[model samples]
Target: MKTYLQAFDLWEIVNVGIEPPMLRPNPTLAQMRQHNEECAKKTQGDVLPTKQCFRHDLYKNHGL
Candidate 1:
């Protein structure tokens, strides 16, 4: 059996096997807008939000 490295770096950032400390699915559109507004306030301006950008065709074609 192969042993994995214990150190964390970019490669271990998004491993699915580990539990995320602050991961949650975005809520409905109204809640999303509220969250977006709050995030914009932190940035001190409007930010073009792309949290849920999707390219269904690409994933479908590429077998992602």
Candidate 2:
């Protein structure tokens, strides 16, 4: 078994670890801003504000 393992090529093992390039580039800052605006419009006034939602007393009582 040791001899068989030694016979395998090290370069082939290293080459297999390489990752492929991304097919699409990342979204720009403008795209991120547009997405945030859309989400805010959808959720506005329907969801609790972060400050209220994350209050320690609210979590302690509500177990959320």
Question: When superposed on Cα atoms, how far off is each prediction in RMSD?
Answer: 13.6, 19.0
lDDT to native, each model: 0.40, 0.48
The true-versus-predicted C-alpha distance at residue 16 of model 2, in Å, is 40
After the best TM-score superposition of candidate 2, give how far the Cα of residue 21 lies from its true spot, in angstroms: 22
Quote model 2's TM-score. Answer: 0.33
TM-score of each: 0.30, 0.33
- Cα lDDT of candidate 2 equals 0.48
lDDT of candidate 1 over 1-64, digit per residue (tens): 0012212221223444554233258668887666555534543321223212345555777887
- Number of residue pairs clashing in candidate 2, backbone atoms closer than 3 angstroms, sequence gap of 3 or more or interchain: 0
Model 1 CA lDDT for position 45 = 24
Clashing pairs in 1: none
lDDT (C-alpha) at residue 33 in model 2: 68
What is the Cα-based TM-score of model 1? 0.30
Residue 53 accuracy (lDDT) in model 2: 52
